[model samples]
Target chain A: MNERLTYESLIAAKLEQLAPLPALADDIWARISADLDREMPTDESEAPSGGGPSLPGTGGMLWPGLGALLLAVAGLLYWYSQRSGIPVPAPSPQSVPADARPASSLPADTGSPKGIYQQPAAVARPVEAMPVPLADSAAAPSTGKLPPPVLPLPDDSRPQPAASASQEPPPGQPPATAGDKASPPPAIDTPIKKKPRGVTGISNNDYRIVPDKKDSARKKN
Target chain B: MNTPDEDIQLIIDGCIANSRKAQELLYRQFYGFAMTVAMRYSRDEMDAADILSHAFVKVFKSIQQYDAARGSFHAWLKRIVVNEGLDHIKARNRFDSPAELDQAEEVPVDHTVVEQMSAGDILQLVQKLPPATHAVFVMYAVEGYNHREIAERLNISEGTSKWHLSEARKTLQQLLQSHR
Candidate 1:
């Protein structure tokens, strides 16, 4: 009779008796409230819980529109180039002229095919009127010599354009001291003569001479 | 004065109306029953509490969808709690591999032995069983789910469900014998 207590029957009997539960209502409700508050929308404006797919917006069109714009711009450029009949220079080994081969004058490593496409490190540009490069020309007589190094002019040493025009000798000419005979300086206190001129179109009638009142008073006294 | 069914119906209506007071009332009403179902499937009381709380949250969210014509709210709530517990067990990845189903040997227990045991003692023993076996045993013996239903819910074969049930029984019998 005691053996008749099967595991199923025993489990069923135990399950019938409600097991003592720890106080979980307040804690469980707190969790529920927190979770619900976090998930549930506060406003009625929330999208209905139908959970349907949203309609596409301009945001989706942006990438394709951008791609089309790029394609159109490229097509317009290609059309313009074709209509102009301008030969678009393609990068090719044969396109490089034999006379344009100055890469040997560059670094030894730059003599490679890649260097043919690359611009020389030093490009010849008329940066200044200074005779400093003449000194380099005086130093290097070789025709294959590299271009003279362009030295930066010091701000203080560089002559102002107006000062150079009025006072300095022309760039190509030597200084007076550098010549065979040194020129004498002009007298510092010499009063310069004033030359009155006439307007070319209106003749001398357009020129009105206003006398300095202070000068006139000094002369009168 | 409203009858118990009327009172419950009023509460249900309130819950559907998104009334916090009604939701709290419903949660408090079924907390014990929910905990009991959850505890049998969980590793500990905290785990059981977590399952209960999450299930109640689900209940509150989907209370509008609950149809009373199908069954009582008690059955509905219990089903939710049991499913929630099962989800937790599944998330633990306990059912990925099958347990030693063939090695389980049944041990006989006297009627006096189970009579002397408390529900808490039985729950402890059940909790000590392997996760899949514990779930299968609770579903078959306590929740009254058939082998086919258990297999469908657990995504296992009916034979596997029976094996887990037998293993659970053997483990429980051994624990009971040791306890005595």
Candidate 2:
């Protein structure tokens, strides 16, 4: 114990020997007892065997599953629109202001002698810039309903019924004047549904049922 | 491998069972050592008392986690008290920056200075150093922690830890000479 008091070891040894404040022991023990009582958990249901509340489990998975399903639906919608070559509409058309729409999306004002040619949008490309053309401008009836003959366009892939362009001028060229006369309408763009190979020979008669065996003999051809 | 006192063992068993008398007994038995550890790390008696109280609460709650494989109950309790001291320092932001470390002469004080002064006087001089330097001195010298361990615990560089310890030694020497 009679070692030289070097600065390194001196402070450590001195600090250890120094006594703390009087009654610090009593004060600390009082506080510890109070804390122990407060932390003891009065209600049995409120406490777990491990001395804490158990984490809620069943409710956690539902939201993630719902979110995944929503994500998958959104992905399917995006994929279908991409596959079908359809121009998906804005998420909320009514919520957006007219001025907010892009320049290309807006249609131009047209006032020619031929008048407005409104085409059915189902079989047509949804290009808002291209005006509809009449199938036969001269032969067009002044009044009464007439379904414009939707002819098939020359396409290597799916057989699409396109607007007949015989009466109208080819697209992207100069607009034809009344003196130039109207050309035939262009071919339509409808996708023709092809019958699958497996169900080709099945007739509708196979689905039809006779009321009874004698009832089939009484039926007229 | 010193055997524990029968009374201490009985008190510990009672503490584990949440007996109030046993807990109080345990607290009274170790409060001096705990207080000493706390006071050494703290600036004032009040802060020391606070750190001591906090350590006891922790010791009581986590006493179950302590095992014979680790070390003696006293050592385990000392570890908790030291940790509480560190926490107190951290919470108060008591550790001053290295830039604030005082520049003291490298020359050692007279050999008889410590013999002439009480241990309290020396500790008071230690407390006079920047909190950061004091903590390093206590941890490295008293607690036997290396600079690397000090750096890891205090979230500082090893160089910084070394600087604090060096600065602490210098200040203590100067304080010793001044006290004489």
Candidate 3:
């Protein structure tokens, strides 16, 4: 306790005996007033010296103006999504109508331009989820075993389709023409339909189903 | 002319009303006393200035909460300044790392040596202490905060606060001995 008293008193006396503290009044007030101006910005009487006079309040329309701008941006986005035929995700899943589910839930309209683009996404599902035609089972081999299901490879490993007419189609799909083979497939999952290979008279060798290139070109034009 | 107390009361009322002139008056009135407190906790004048600015801003923003009956205005202002200084030290990431606890045994200082040194000389030596030690010493020796209050403020145990206080005295004693 004596040690504490000794040092504490000594330091206190020295601090008191020193010359008066330097005046930082003006310097500190300048800085603090600037900070005060920033915090209480609505206090026009306190705006920093040399700054332009405070502008009159806009009669509290700032929020309404911001709300209108936000609404306009939302309207524009909806219009663009409709014009481009790109589906806008509904804000709430419950608000999405039964018929308005993703394109994957709709029938594969192999005939429509929309279907052509959406087919690859459908094909990208796991093999078990794909709809195998009932006829495929009857087309199995005599030994009572089905042929191996064709699996899609990742893009790096998939063979790049050429404009060759000789590329045989999957069993259910009609033969593709040279023009149909020339157009590139959609950049998503491969458009190749799964083949149940034991179907009679189809070659035992691998075959790729090419998307209808002629139709794709027609749709693009 | 109003008494100084009455004038300060009026200033406080002006501050609550968001009067710019009243705030400037209050800041000017207290600047020296507050800066002296801040300089003790800071490493240098510039840091002291920064702490003082932040503390005054707090004072203005929270002026509505200052109750005259609880304490004098200077006591309240001093509390805010000390808190701001501690915050500055914490922000610089300096309050946590102390030398191992075993190394901080209390050292008795020769009072004659400290008495001979001017405040500026002692302040420079205190600034040379590790940041955590500096904060602990100022809170304990100068500001009269007990170990428990220091611990609560710095978010350490009382034992740790005592350890830091010891560390500060040990370092300051060494510095003073070298000066002698």
| TM-score leader | 3
The lDDT ranking, best first, is: 3, 1, 2
In model 1 chain A, the worst 10-residue window by lDDT is A178-187
- Per-model tally of clashing residue pairs: 0, 22, 0
Candidate 3 local distance difference test against the native: 0.66
In candidate 3, the residue pairs with backbone N, CA or C atoms under 3 Å apart (3 or more residues apart, or in different chains) clash, namely: none
What is candidate 1's TM-score for chain B alone? 0.92
Error in Å for residue A122 of model 2: 95
Two-way lDDT contest, 1 vs 3, winner: 3
The candidate with the higher DockQ, 1 or 2, is: 2
- In model 3, where do residues sit more than 4 Å from their true spots? A1-3, A16-23, A46-221, B97-104
Q: What TM-score fits each model?
A: 0.52, 0.50, 0.54
* Lowest lDDT 10-residue stretch of candidate 2 chain B: B96-105
- Best-matching candidate per DockQ: 2
How good is model 1 by TM-score? 0.52
lDDT of 3 by residue, B95-155 (tens): 5644435323557788888878889898888899888888988888877787778889999
Over A25-103, each residue of candidate 1 has an lDDT whose tens digit, in order, gives 6777788877876776333214332364544465367689989999999999766544443332221222222122222
What's chain A's TM-score in each predicted model?
0.16, 0.21, 0.25
> Fraction of reference contacts reproduced per prediction?
0.49, 0.62, 0.47
> How good is model 3 by TM-score?
0.54
